[model samples]
Target: MTDATSRDGTRSGSTAQPVGGAKGPDELRRQIEQTRGELGDTVEELAGKADVKGRAKARAADLKDRAGAMTVHLRGSAGHTVRGGAGRADPPSRRARHAVRAGLGHPRAVLVAGAAAGVAVAASLARRHRHGPC
Candidate 1:
């Protein structure tokens, strides 16, 4: 997280390299430009970390993108049933459909989901008490 500084104590932003006996101006200019670009990227990364809302938004956007990609992939693999098309391109087998039907209003599913929610809430409360707000 430290910026590279020159002998004058200003941020030179470049990595330590031997000052050659005869390096050209153009080469130095290119090095300076590269350093500036790297510095800009580092600053942006630090700023992004400090911005809570921005980080949340970025994470949400990334998750949304991943979800969209997954949806596309699932549709391509699972066929027309993904979007309520005219007909199922790859309909579920009868036994599988029956099993799913039997799962309707299943107490096990309810119990598992409820238990997971309870555990999550308990963990969250414990974390809050330990850390005290965020």
Candidate 2:
């Protein structure tokens, strides 16, 4: 099998040429400059990836922008529902109201629960009647 690496240690398919290969001085200088430029680009890319704080800041800025857009959209649709933490009421009344609204939305579930309770009471009474005061 053919060797994958050239004699100068560069990979066969790589853009870099062998250091002491048969080429003119101007061509060699151009190749060296091109390799340096490619190396600089690679180093910049790696440095950007290594910058955790910068990446976090960028991600935070993106989230803030998205949240601002959503807030604007919500405000346009329903101003009353688009409340911040400025003047919220206590949790008890808020939770009670939410529960009441949910109960109203699912009448069938409430009816099913009431029916189940009635069935359990009737079964207990029948058992007591059959056992005759025991």
TM-score of 2: 0.49
**Candidate 1: RMSD to truth:** 15.7
Best by lDDT: 2
Kindly give the number of clashing pairs for every candidate. 0, 0
Q: For residues 55-99, what per-residue lDDT tens digits would candidate 2 score against the true structure?
A: 999999999999999999888766454454455665898989997
lDDT of 1 by residue, 1-134 (tens): 77665675456445556334128888888878988999999999998889999889989999999999999998787665645665645456876777667677597996788799999999999999999998
Cα lDDT, all candidates:
0.79, 0.82
Off by over 4 Å in 2: 1-22, 79-101, 104-134
Error of 2 at 38 (Å): 0.7
Clashing pairs for model 1 are none
Q: What TM-score does prediction 1 earn?
A: 0.33
The stretch of ten residues in a row with the least summed lDDT in candidate 2 is: 13-22
